[model samples]
Target: MADLSVAFVGKKLRSPIGVASHAVLNEGLSGTEKETEQLKAYSDLGVGFVHTPFICPEEEHPKDAPPGWKFQGIRSREPFMMEGLLVATEARRIMCRLNAGLNMIENLKENLPDDVAVIANMIGPGADPDGWAEHCKSAEEAGADIIEMNVSCPLPASEAKAVQEYSTGEMSEAAGSLLGDSLQLLLPVVKAVVEECSIPVGVKLTPETGFPRIIGFAEGIRNAGAKFISGINAPITVSPPDIYKNGQGKWPGMTTNPICAALGPWDRFLLYRNLGTISLFVPEIELAGIGGLVEPEHVVEAMMLGARVCEFSSGILWKGTDIIKESLEFLETYMDRQGYNSIEEIIGKGVKYIVPVEQVDWRQEDFIATVDDRLCTRCGRCANNICKARTLEENPLRIVIDSRYCIGCGLCQAICPEHAVSIVEQKHPVIGISVDE
Candidate 1:
């Protein structure tokens, strides 16, 4: 069997797959117990690591705050096909207080298997360098194998009302994405934490930081002495409204739409963006892929794109602990089949193929669209509407391709439903002058 074991930031993890930081169903002061149980359950499934729900530095939470989680496009029988989820929870209801978080870490360390590392997913006093350093030091003291700075939770800036209030200086701190997006604000915190803590410190970055900006963020993080970067956290957005109900909100209990977190499969591309960009430009720091990964194959895809570790948040919520088990099983089988003996062999393997558009050799003349006449349904979906290179003829009600104009765009092949259209290398080159001539 192929070894799933991999070294991540000086720690040898049993597998590259683990759980991401997310809210749990626990409530009240004893919620830490529930979170601990959940982590234990994940460890029992043979996961390499598990992040505790976002833990803040506060010692106590308010008594009356509310918590909620709702989804859109959810069919009771098939829950996996959700458009997104709205996570609106007060600190009292979702996060672990500093004391509870430390205890949870201690409990998991004692009970979990030796290979299962307990990562502290900590949200510090936003943008406070010293306070952030102190908070992370506590987690390290509590025996966390790794400290993932929760600067990308989306909650602090997700609410439109809160943001408007924050804009006017009514609120002191809008952390999470607000912190992750600003290198000036976050770099000091990262440096402070790295300086204070003995364990590996990583930043869970926000999706709001895009392309060139994220490249700068990664470079700054590497300079700050942090070991790795994880995320594209669920981006903040308003869920789709009910068009049939005069634009009412689609969440289960709400009539009004509010800005919230978007998760699930839609996040995979953004995760790839982080993994691929940082791997190419800022190769010194490692990466952990999170956001939009929902299947066993998605884990491998992240690894191939330069993610050393892959974590699932929405996938676990939608599919249960079996997601981890199935992913581990698939990884072992896939590695053996593909002749890979260790996880390092697959990490960043696909990154070399990624290139700027200007560098791509379009190869427009090498291929053309071909339709298998036997399987063609004579559907004009491709030719009539989209591609000028293909034409529908009435003699036998057939679709024909004009290779001279095809350009090998593959629009016709992509639109065909009958499995008839294919883009294949042509026997004759269209662009080059005839050698025989």
Candidate 2:
């Protein structure tokens, strides 16, 4: 049997899989009971941790806002298989009032399994470092095992009407991706929280903070005393308008297109960016993977790339609570099959292999493409579209590969509907050959 528990921020998680912070599903005007019930359901399913939906510092929801239950409204569309999931909503929808959020944390701590942890996902007053610090401290006192500063939510910044109008840049008071992207704003808040709280503190980062720049952001967060970085909050995008409906939005019951948060299978690469870049550049800090992870295999993929724990938000919406159970089972079977005895053995296993492309040895001369005749259906899909290496030989109605011209690029192998093409090693390896030849 494999050990599924993993250490995150000096605490042990029963499993690396946890529920990502997302909109709470509330049944009525008094939303706390339903929220607590939903969380308890996740707890019963054996999640390692659960994040309280993005909690704000205000004691009550803004009076101008709609009811808490209504504010949790979300709209989603799956345009195609490749688009994965596109989720859109006004930022107010996911906000949880401070008193309600703290109570939920207290309730969870009292009732959750001993191995389960509670991460308070907090969004504080952006401009006030002291205020942010105070909010974190309150969650700590309220029994949150960890504090995840959710500074990368997409909806807040996505609400901005025009990007071209501001050469100087626009800042929102909402304190999400805007805070995570700007170091001057983020570092002070992180420092204040670390000073005020005794527990592990982490930042959930924005996907907007892309590579090279992400390196600087990670360095700054680590310097300011954050223990881990979890991401990425869904990236902002507009769903394609319905061409037949006079460019109306695809969201059901809404005619106008609103800038929404994108989720689902497409996010794995962005999640890998956070995992790979931070793991390689900022080894002192930890990572929790959260974006586009929709399947059991994605959990292991995230771990190998240095995610200590992985959370499923959109995945849960797509696959349901069963994703957690499936992931835990998958982890155990995968670890044992791979000869990994513990979760620690899998963490950061792939990081060392991620090198600059310039440093990769292509070794063209040692490999060549080969066609397996036994499996070939003579489809000619590869011969017409693939490369100069393959051509249809008419007599037997088969595709033939000229070894001299074959570069082993594997395009044919990848596109082969019949799985007849393969890249294989050369029996007599040639030395000192340029790729162009």
Give lDDT: candidate 2, residue 408: 78
lDDT tens readout by residue for model 1, 96-156:
6778888888988899887878889988885788989998899889889999998887777
Give me the candidate number with maximum TM-score.
1
lDDT of each: 0.81, 0.80
Per-model clash counts, in order, read: 0, 2
| TM-scores of all predicted structures | 0.91, 0.90
RMSD per model, one decimal: 4.1, 4.4
